[model samples]
Every structure is written in structure tokens, then in C-alpha cells.
Target chain A: MIKDITLGQYFPGKSFVHKLDPRMKIILLTFFIVFIFAARNFVSLGIMAAAVFAVICISGVSPKMYFKSIKAIIFIVLFTACLNLFYGTGDPLWQWRFLKITQSGINTAIFIAVRIIALVLISAVLTYTTSPTDLTDGIERLLKPLSVFHIQVHEIAMMMTIALRFIPTLLEETDKIMSAQKARGADFESGNFITRLKALIPILVPLFVSAFRRAFDLAMAMESRCYHGGEGRTRMRVLKYSKKDYLALGASCLIFAGVIICSIYLPATVRTGM
Target chain B: MKFIEVKNVVFAYDAAEEGEEPKTVLKDISFEIEKGSFVALLGHNGSGKSTLAKMFNGILEPESGDIVVNGLNTKEESTILDVRKSVGLVLQNPDNQLVASIVEEDVAFGPENLGIPPEQIRQRVDSALKSVDMYEFRAHAPHKLSGGQKQRVAIAGIIAMEPECIVLDEPTAMLDPQGRKEVMDTVIKLNREKKITIILITHYMDEAVQADRVIVLDDGRIIRDGAPKKVFSEVEFLKCHSLDVPQATELAYRLSSSGMKIEGTPLNETECISAVIKALS
Candidate 1:
């Protein structure tokens, strides 16, 4: 089903990763991404892979669920790996017309493939663990410093969260509209690209009109609830850093520091010798 | 003192085109809604009832006159938020009104904006959900709920703010039969048990029968204002204005108009049935 797209979807549970504060998970995800990019050798990449696996295991989410995120970026991963295959610097293994694949190209391809997988899985763990509401609150809290610049951080976060909440509703509405048009014998699927684009005009017009009407209604409701601004607003689910959060933070920092040290001191020592 | 005071409040929408006249939606409307009263505002489409409900919460300021809610004039800039705090308004579309995905989180949206303490906000959300019997669905997504349940959660959202009065403008208009009853029961319970004043704007004559006072509007004017039995008894007056009376009241009126001597006008089913039984006896 179209609703079953697993990207950025969360599963509610009380696993160790889910129990961590959203802010902590967000921060850890940032460090995890950096660590993945910093690893240039097999050992450091293996460490990155191990850390992601550990998070997935503790999160109690199926590895298959985490793999679903990769499906979304498979094109980019394949493109990059294919591009790197002909650009390696050492010992050309196959030569074609004006193109060659080297032993070092194969090694670099493997490294990048691991990095991409680790990066996607590490971020998937974040989304899979934290609900969208908590994620928004965490983002608002993290960006509170931007308020000094007079940026409307809370408003932006509120907009994002509302948009997220409406995604499924709007998608469902679109599905219904498509079906209704189909029932009326409106051809949507068999046409050429331009004709297919033309077919969507019926759906887009009503969707836009309804969306504007909903925006007006929502604004009135918000005003009725005494929403002036973020100045005096209080939150029900207050974000806090507990002992587990601190422990998770400490572990992420250790791994980040280890990767940085390894990258600086052992760049060529642990290279994959494929 | 009356909970809400409207003094000849006048409002109009902007003109649609150049040289076109701006349409007046509410004109010279003056009424006082007392504290803890269940008043239903009944009007047909374009009768200005929804426009009047908006004025009560300062969503639309009157062009000429004034509206004071809980002793704060909605005209003053500083008092608008405070006035809104006292007079919470629920709207027609249940889907648009809910901001949070989860039930409890959506309930918390109101008090959170009011700047309540975290612990107190939690308490209010819990109590509000319980009052609406939606406590079990606290963690459930609002989108997944039935239309009636969503409207109930919307009411719970207003209740969390603990407003003295709630103005619901066609809240159950989009709800199914069962959902409408669920919302009406919650509204009545809030009024009777919690003593929260209710200003319900509806076109459903049956729902208006539950109100203590029914105010009828036509052409942006108050055509009738009285108890439900008294107002619904004026069958011709309402019919002329393109409005309806409750089914029982209409039947009773039909029976009376046909030369039968029905002693009393019936506003609901029980009263209608009993009146028929008495006439037979």
C-alpha cells in the first residue's frame, strides 16, 4: 500500500533507543553521520557499521525495517558507486573504450558503499525511535539559540509538524481523487508523460482549493485557542536529559573522537587491500 | 454580570471587486448571554450566525460596535488574547481544527498556548480527555479517529483551556448521526456538570431543542429569542425565514393547525408523545 512507505516512519515502543530523549537521538545521529563520512579505511568503517547495528538491535526494530530507508536512496547509492568504479588510481583491472576499472576503484567502491549504508541506517534509527511530535520539539529546543537572531523557530517547527501531520491525510485524499476520476473514466495511467501531467490538473485544483480552505479554518481555530506566539507557550511533553540519555551521549562522543583520531593517525595503515 | 455582552455589533466582509459593495454579515446585533447558560444560535445559511460567533471570540472585530467577553472588551488590542482565553471557539471542520497527531497532545495544544506549567498542562489534558471519554485514546492518532470522536477530541481541546464559555460554530455539521449525538452529549455534560456556558451555533433544529435558550437569526438580525418551546412554536415565523423547527414541534404544530386542540407545544419526542397520549385520554 502507498501508506506503507517506511521512510521516516516511527514504531512506538519502550526500547532503549526509543527511551532516549529526541534531542539526544538527534545529536547522536549528527555525530554518527560525521563518523561515517570520516571513515576512510576498513577498520573505521567496520566500527561505524557495528555502531549502527547495535542501535538497530537495541531499538527492537527489525533490520528489514531499517533497510527500507535504503530503498529510497538506492539510485543515488548505485550512481555514486558506479561513478567511483572507473576513477580508482591503482592497478586497472579492466579496460574499456576510454574507461578503466582499477583494483583501488573496487576498494573505494566498497568503502563508499559501506559509508552510504551506515549513514542511511544511523539516520533511520533516529526517525524510527522518535515520534514526529517529539522530533519537532527537539528541533525547536535545539534551535532556541536562533531566537536571539529573531528567527521564528517555534513557528517554523510548528509549521513542519503540522505539515507532517497532514501528509497521510493529503495522500489519502489524493488516492481517493484518483480513484474517483478513474471511476468517471478519466484516463490517468495510460497517457504519455505530458498527457499524464494534464490528467493531474483535476486532482491538483481541488486539492489546492481544499488545502487553502483548511488553512483558513486552522488559523481561526488556532487563534481561538489563544495562540498569539511562542513567547509564553508551555509544552506538555518536556524534553529532558536523563541518565540513559547522558550515557548514550557519552558513547557517541567516544566513537566520534575515536573516528577523528583514527582518520588523523592511521589513514593509510588500515586501507582495504582488495 | 452577563458572561458576554454585545452592543450593537456590526461587521462586514470586504468587497469582492472594484466598485462592488462590501456585504454586511452582522448588523446592529445586541444580546447578553448570561453565565452558565446553554444558548443555541439557530440560522439558515448566510444568516450571520457564524459571523456573530466569530465576534464573540474576537476572531472578527465588529466594524462599529463593541463585544466584551468576561469583562474584557474584544476591541482593545491587549484584551484580545485574554478574551480568547475566556471564550474558546470550536469550528465546523473537525479535521482542520486539530493540530497535534495524538489525542492527548492535541488536547494539550490549548493550555500549552495559555502558558500553563508543564505538570498542570498534563493534568488538564488528562482531565479534559476523561471528561470526553477519550482518555483511552490519548496516544492514538487524531486522523485515525471517527469523525464524531475527532469532534469530541476537539471539544476536549477547548476544555483543556478551561474557558468560561465555548462557542461552537456548526461543530457537528460535518459529523455523521452517531458522531453528532456523541458531541451533543459531551456539550450538555460540560454545561450541566462543569457549569461551562455553551453558545452552540447550529442549523439542526433537533439539537437546538436541548438548549435552554434558542436565538433565531435571519438577514443578520435576531428575529426570535426565547425558550426552545416558545421559539419553535412559531412555525410560520421560522418557515418564512427559511428555517425549521424540531420534528416533534412541527408535528404538534401540524396537529394544532389542522384544528385539533393540542394543549401544549412539544419541543422533543417525549413531550410530543405525552401530549398525544393526553389528547387521546
Candidate 2:
């Protein structure tokens, strides 16, 4: 049901991975993603996967949940694997009248699939440990240097926080309107494509009206509270880097360097014509 | 000093088309609410009770006349924030007014907007939640809460702003009977303990009976203003305006008509019981 749809979901924990500064986690996540794409061969891919698995374990989140997070992209993973298997040009290992699978094709398919899985798992690890508010706080702090260019970092962060705050409210409103319309015998299900779409109008119109009303009320309330675009605003929980964050950052940097070296020095698999 | 003063205020919604008569919602409304007083506004639908409440905080400016709060004119744009800060407004629908997912964060919203330092904001939020007895649910999502709990949280949000007066526009309208009683008790407790002025706009006669003074509105005009007993005593006038006195008051009026002597009008069940017992003695 709708209750199970967790938005910006973060699992709370007290592990070293969870305790690291959010800013450092964000930076490390970005570095991890870049290095994921930089991975050229199986040796580098193995190193990337190992590093992601270690973090995931240290974070204390079950591996099943991490895979479940990537469930939505299962189709993309399979589709890319299929594309790599057939489109890769090399000596054919298996052949039919018009279809062929080469030695290079098998290697390419495994490489692409592992890369996609590794990329997704690493990103999930970052979100799994970092709460949405902390993520925004970290981003705002990281982007503080951009303020010299007159960028409104705090405003953007506040906007994000507000947006996160309203998601549940909006969801609840949508549910209410849907139920109200249903009570009036407005059919939302069991209809043709166009009929079902037309039925949505009753639910949608009221939802939009209520949303706009809430937005206006919230804006007025914010103004009354004297919010004037985040100038001279001080935070309650200021982001301060700790020793744990420094150590995590150092470890991530080492992993990044190690992956690059492995991709260059490690022996890559070779395929000869069948 | 009067915490809120309305002087000959007139307000209207602009007509849908040009050259058409505007819909006058409040016609020459005037009232003064002293600090720490509880005033209830009672009327049928379209009685302009809500319009008057909005005007108190400058949410809707008067078309003519002035509204002064703590000696500051609400018409002055510069003092509008000060006026709003002095008087908090809570709307009927608890769902619409709450802007935060978490209870504590919603309570912190008003003070946070005031740019109070984070530490002070935390204290205000905690105290506001404690005042409403919602401190335990500080981290819980508001949508999962019951109607009465959400309404109380909404009140807590307003209380966190630390306003001198709190104007509620039919806050219990959407709640069940139990929820209504919970909300009313919370309002009464805040007025009693915090010494905050209360301007309650409601249609429920039972609720009006608990206020220090009741102002009845009819078609954007104040038809009656006095204590609940005095106002309900004019049963004929109230009925003419498509309203009714509380059941106990009506029963007492019937008993008095049937050759029984009652010293005063009974606005509630206990009062009626006491009057009946005294009359028998």
C-alpha cells in the first residue's frame, strides 16, 4: 500500500560509516561514482565491488535491502547485459543463422552487468547511511564556497528541507481526495485507458486546489516568522568535520587510487578468434 | 491595555465582475479584547465571524476603518509582522495548517521563521509540545496522528510563537465529539495557564457557553454581545436568527414557562440540574 513507499528513506545506525560526517560521505560517494566509470577491466571492477561491499557491511545494512533498492532497475541491468552480449564484435563462440555470441561478447556482458550493479550499490550505501536533512545540510555546507559567486546555498538547502517536509503532507492529501471522490461513486479503477484517465480529473482538480492553498498558507506563515532568504541565519546543528570523517575520506581516497592502478597494471582477459 | 481592538471595520470580497456590487462580508464590525480574556464568536454560516478573526491579525485588511493591536495600527504595513506576531491564527482544517511531517519540526516552524537562534527554537518547540502534551510524539509524522492530536499539534505550533492572543477559526469543526472536547480543553487550559487572549470563532453553541463573552453575528453584523447566559436568555431573538440556545437553557426556559421560578438561565447541564434542585427545595 502507499504506506510502504518510503521517501528519502535512511536507516539509522551507530556504525563508523553512519557516524562519518555527511559532507565527507557525499564527497566520497561522488568520488566512488567517478571511479566506477573509470574502471576499465575485471581487476578494477573487482576492487570497486570489494570497496562498496566493505562499506555496506560496515554500515550494518543488510545486503538484501541494498539489492532490493536496485530492484527497480532490474530491467535496465538485463537489457544492457543483452546489448553487450550481441553487439560486441569478435570471433563467434556460438553461432546460429543470424545470431552470434563471441568470446569478447561474454566478457563484455559480465563487465557491463557488474559495473551497473556496483554503481547502484555504492550510491545506495551513501543514502542508506545519510538522512535527507543531513544530506541537504552537507550539500549546503559543501556549496558554501559558491556563495562568493553570489549563489544562495542556504536558500536552496531550505527549499530542499521544505520540499522533503511536504512530501508526506501531499501524499496524505492525495489519499484523502481519492477516498472522497471514491465515496461519491467516482470510478478510478476498472475502466479503459481514456476512461480511467478521465476519472482522474475529479481527484486531480481538488488535489491541485488544496496543494496551492497549502503552498500559499505555508509561504505566508514563513514570511510571518521573518524568514528573509537565509541571510545572517545561524544553524542549530552546525556541520563540523570529525576524526572519523577524516579517516573515512582518507580510506576512500586510497581506494580510488588503488582502483586506478589496478585498472592499468592488472592483466586483462584476451579473446582469440574461434 | 487592550490586546486587540477593532474599530468600525468594514470588509468585502471584490465582485466577480466590474460594476457589480461587492459582497460585503463584515459591515462596520467593532470589538475590543483585553489581554487574558476569552471571547467566543458564534453565528450561523456566512455570518462573517471568520472575516472578523482574519482582520484581527491583518490577514485581510479592512476596506474601511482601522484595527489596532497593542497600540500598533494593523493598517500600517511596517507593523503588520508585529501585529501577526502578537496574535496567532489557527484555521479550521488541522490538516492544511500543519506544514511539517514531524511533530517537533512543525512546532518549531513559527519560531524558526522568526529567526530565533536554533537553541531557543528547540526550547520553544519542546515547551510548546509539552504544553499540548504532545512531547512524546515529537519525532512522529503528523499525518499518522488522530484528528484531535493533529489539532492540538496545530495549536502547539501557534503557541510556540508565544503570541499574546490566539485566534482559532472553527478549529473543532472537522473533529468528532471527543476530539472537539479535547481541543476545547486545550484552548481553555492555554487561556487559563498562559493568560493568553482567546478569540474563538465557532458555530457550536455548547462551546460558546464556556467563553467569558459571546458575540453573535448575523449577516456580517453583530446582533448580540454579552455573557452566554445573557445571550441565551433571549431565546426568541436567537430562534429568529435561525439559531438556538443550548438544550439545558431551552429546558429551563420551558420549566419557567410552566409556572416554575428559576433564578437564572441555565446554559449547561450542571447549571440546569442545580436550578431544578433549588426550585424543588
Q: How do the predictions measure up, each by TM-score?
A: 0.95, 0.90
lDDT score at residue A237, model 2, on the 0-100 scale: 59
Scored by DockQ, the top model is: 1
Report per-candidate TM-score of chain A alone: 0.90, 0.92
How does model 2 score on DockQ?
A: 0.44
What ranges in model 1 sit over 4 Å off? A1-7, A93-98, A269-274
Top candidate, metric TM-score = 1
> For residues B139-256, could you state the per-residue lDDT of candidate 1 as single tens digits?
9988889999999999999999989999999999999999999999999999999999999999999999999999999988999999998898889989989999899989988988
A1-274: candidate 1 lDDT, tens digit per residue: 5455542588888999999988888888887887787686777778788888888899998878777789988888888888878878866789988799988787787777778878888888888888888898889999999999999999999998789777777777778887888899989888799999999999898888888898899999999999888988999988789999999988877877777777777765325422
Fnat of all models, as shown: 0.86, 0.33
Q: Which pairs of residues collide in model 2?
A: A225-B113, A225-B114
Off by over 4 Å in 2: A89-100, A136-163, A176-186, A220-229, A232-235, A263-274, B17-19
Tell me the deviation in Å of residue A128 in model 2: 3.3
